[model samples]
Target: MNIDVLELTAELVKYESISRATNVPVTRHLAKVLRALGFKVEMLPYTDAAGVAKLTIVARLGRAEKGGLSLMSHDDVVPAGSADDWTGNPFQVREHGGKLYGRGACDMKGPLAASICAACRFTAGDLRQPLYIVVTSDEEINALGAREVVDRSKLFADLRHGYGVICEPTCLQVVHAHKGSLGLTITSKGRAAHTSSLKGVNANLKMIPFLNEMRKVNESVLTSRRYRNDEFKPPHSEWSIGINDNNVATNVSPAQSVCTVNYRPMPGTDTNALVRRTRKCASDLGLKCVVHRTGSPLYTPKDAPIVRTSLALAGRRTPTTVAYGTDGLAYSEQMKQLVVLGPGDIAQAHTVDEWIEVDQLHKGVELYTRFIDHVCVQGLA
Candidate 1:
């Protein structure tokens, strides 16, 4: 079957894989396409703790040994908000003025199409090194699918080859590093009573001092030169807390309040350390602070061959780091040498009407083609 990158991107966008419940169709669609390409395909299935149908599409086109590169993208997208907010249907691809607009158009499906097309092109030419493709679920949902891939243990060793390219939107710049993010929950307890009862402690009142302390933690991040990375936009680790549930029904004092803090930690800074510090701060404040869960930051040196060649082909400077996390960290940790390069801009992703430049998509095709040449045809053989 002939594959048109743009059309495939459009077809992919049409599938509303909002969350795990709706991901089967998208994964099957990708698998069908890959199977037709003559690759050995595997459906790695797992049931989440919540018993969601989780599947990862893994296909290999060549030998696994001696190491090869795989192209990866997530099949899921965040739920589209308010239909009235978009000029057109968020699920339907609309093209005007050299741009393709739709949900997940920029978030990922755009790059996914480009990567698949590049792989098809490479396979058509009988590339020597193995080329693999994996379309996994749950990237937008706490990195669950990727964490499953890692936990499976044997998948990494089974790959035979190690390197991978995470087709995340990067506007064609080679993204070698990116920060890690963790979602934390903090809770404060108090006694409930009437507002007139001066003796009753307001949970809202107890949260104020702790919130200020959280702000100080964030501010401390801004001043920490140790966390600086010139490649990232903000160039610093950041932390912010929000009261997810704050209610004191006016006359009555609420007994409990919960705050969710989002922490984005840079490569040099240890996410664990920051998490530990936050927990201690919560402890010192006499509030229950939970570490929740965390992910490792991704960092691939710019000097690596894959990074250098990717930058040289794109004719653009390699970014130091992207503030947003990707499936790249898992790939890097598992594959050891992973480079992130793809089309579209993060700014456009997850917006009401996400779009990708047609020209950028074409450029991505060319870059991926050249990368295949460097890694498989020219470099591998």
Candidate 2:
């Protein structure tokens, strides 16, 4: 079963597995393919917050007791927006000028195809250890699929002391660290009434103080050395704030106002303290504060075995850090070593007419094949 990487990538992109919808279709297809390729496939199913049924596929080949290489990629992609934004159908692959264009072409499906093709090059009997392929859902939204795999999958449990690769778009460069994310929602409630009556409490009035405080916090994070990590570009934790009110008419007093804060935490930064401060401010203002989602930053030392091997495989001299988050945040603690290395550039991801160079896909297959040969077949750490 020598899978063509480009064809596999095209097949994957055709599935409409956007983060908000169920990824069962694509995942089930992948499960079938893996099973045909002589891998034991486990389907982990769960319902998302939207009440949509979702799934994660964990497939293993060879001796699955422990200590092998794990390749991770997410099946779901961010929405491609309007069809007018793309040259062709965003759900279909369009190859031109030595590039493949599609929604997840660069962000993930291409890399995922590369890994599956690489693993297919070897049989279970040829491996001294195991090769695990994890296709997760909702990674673009909350990484809940990865969290579920980490919490429940027995196959994932067997990855202890193993080397892992998160196939995120890094242009084949080796990434040792990436920032984490903390999402907070703050709410203010008040009585609603016509503005002319002046009889209702204004939720915005109550939220104004909190917004001012958040502005101060955001400015502080942007300028203070306390929130800085020199290893990443721009060096400071990004604190982003957004506000919304459901009131449709300006003549009516808003009954509720909502504020959302998304903070990126670095490896050495005190994220808990920042959360505490936010909660305290909300409490003092009589606002309800909720921690919606939290993802830890991935930090693998540059000297780690995975980093060294990945650098060599990718032909890079040194490991670098990224500001974006990945499923690596969920698996970092379980694996002995992990690195983010894959095809395409991050700049091409999530944009209109997203694409991966044809040359990148070819090189990706070669790179992943070498990596599988090194860590799984050759059993080298």
Candidate 3:
């Protein structure tokens, strides 16, 4: 069966599946298609803290086995920042000049389409082991979709292979490693009183020491390792703090001071040590620290089969690394290794009028088909 890649991409684009919005309709659409193609489709629904209904679609082909290949994608896209910022409807697909334009045309939807088409090609072919097509929600916000799937270990016991693909916007290159993200919202509390009183214990003032300590911690993170891998652009983890709100009025001492702290840990760095410092600092300062989001950095060896095969398919020997996080991290607990490789450029991912070249879309499908052949059909021979 010949699946129309662009038509699938456009159909997904038209649904307006933003990270914060409901994705059931789009999930059903994908489920219907995968089911028709003889995949055992499973719709696993989950609810986040904010009560948003999310889902992860796991469609498997062939007999279940360990170390099988999996193609993964996220169903959610980043919010279209402003409607006025776009020339055409951001929710609908627009094809012009050999480019397909829409919100997730590059960041994801394009890869999802290509993966589905590529996996569809195996419907009539025999397989020694299984192949999986996984679509999860909440990647743009925090990769909660993949996290949820990973947490459900028993649900994917047979499919928790050591090899997998994260269909992010890698522009057809294979990404073997990426940085981890840790975010927190800290609040300093104190009694609110008239500024005239010196005993008022200003909440904003209580945050000064914490801020200074965090600065030093961040500096230490930068120098964590003597030599950094040039593969990662910055090649070092970064931390920053933002004072969301502080003094509300000149005459009133604020009752609370709120700030956000985010740290991106590079590969080979001890994330637990960094995490402990932030928590200990907040405890010593009598400030409440709430974890907002946390994603572990993924590091796969360059010589890994997934990386080697993908590189061979793309005719590139070097396996690159990305700065951003992906759904791959969600499956780290289950899958032994995961690589981020797909169609489109990362530069166009979150732009107002994001797009993927038609040529890139076709190439993505071809690469995926060839990958299936190399890993599944040839049995990694």
**By TM-score, who's the top model here?**
2
Q: How many pairs of residues collide in each model?
A: 2, 0, 0
Query: Model 1, which residues run further than 4 Å from truth?
Result: 47-51, 122-125, 158-161, 191-201, 246-248, 317-320, 379-381
Collision pairs in model 2: none
lDDT of 3 by residue, 1-381 (tens): 789899999999988889889887898899999988888887789887789888888888877677667889988888999889998999888999999999999989999999999988886356776778889988888888787677664436777754688888888888998887888888998777788986566788878999998898778767757425567988876678788545668788788888788877666666677668888999998999888657777888888776777788888879988888887666665566788999999999999999999999999999888878877777772
Model 2's TM-score against the true structure? 0.98
lDDT string, candidate 2, 125-187, tens digits: 989989999999999988999999999999988875688899998989999999988899999
Point out where model 3 deviates above 4 Å.
Answer: 153-155, 193-201, 223-227, 246-251, 291-293
Query: Candidate 1, overall lDDT?
Result: 0.78
Under the 3 Å rule for N, CA and C atoms, how many clashes does model 3 have?
0
Model 2 stretches astray by more than 4 angstroms: none
For model 2, give the RMSD to the true fold: 1.0
Give lDDT per model, in order: 0.78, 0.91, 0.82
